[model samples]
Target: MSSDLPALILGVLCGTGGTIGYVKTGSVPSLVAGLGVGALYTYSSQRIRNNLPYGIELALLASTVLAGSSVPRAIKTGKPLPQVLSVLAASGLIYYGVKFMQRE
Candidate 1:
């Protein structure tokens, strides 16, 4: 678990980067954020030797949604639709993903 800290930090950094990218480009930062979170989660899960019933892809999607929404908020865009939708979608994905994992 100790060794996974670097990966976790990397994930957070990537997540932040994605948020920045989205703020600047108004494009979805899904890929970047997903990569970061997936790497960290994978590394941590592996270090702990857990089954990690929730797959990396699902985790990445959830992370992307979680981190992606911050872009609009940070930019102070008055239009709340994109930000709200992104957050809701991300949250839903995560919620369902967790439920799926628990069932496994």
Candidate 2:
């Protein structure tokens, strides 16, 4: 789990950029970036389903990425919803991810 942290962060970055890009301009590249991360994450989580990979984690990850990606757009558009959501999702993911890492 620890070893995957970097990949998770990378996914977060790509997802964030893609989400915001798509939202701001409806660009295909951004949409692709966001969906690509989502697909990869889903595949990985499913592969490890024997460990009880609930859907919540995947949702949190996706939403968090969406929220994070929404930041730049929010800044330009002066919207606060995405940032607020990102904060909430960030808190939840931190707690959840920590608990998950501790599992035997």
Which one wins on lDDT? 2
Distance from true position, residue 85, model 1, in Å? 28
lDDT of 2 by residue, 38-60 (tens): 56555444534445455345644
Q: Which candidate is the best by TM-score?
A: 2
- Candidate 2 vs. true structure, TM-score: 0.41
Displacement of the residue 27 alpha carbon in candidate 1, Å: 1.7
Give each prediction's root-mean-square deviation over alpha carbons.
9.5, 8.1
Cα lDDT, model 1, residue 59: 44
lDDT of 2 at 38: 57
Model 1 steric clash pairs:
none
Which 10-residue window of candidate 2 scores lowest in summed lDDT? Answer: 1-10
- Where does candidate 1 stray beyond 4 Å? 29-104
lDDT of 1 by residue, 1-104 (tens): 34334335444555565576577787575556545554655454354335454344444454554556655664577566446545544554565465456666
In model 2, the Cα lDDT at residue 16 comes to 76
User: Quick one: RMSD of model 2?
Assistant: 8.1
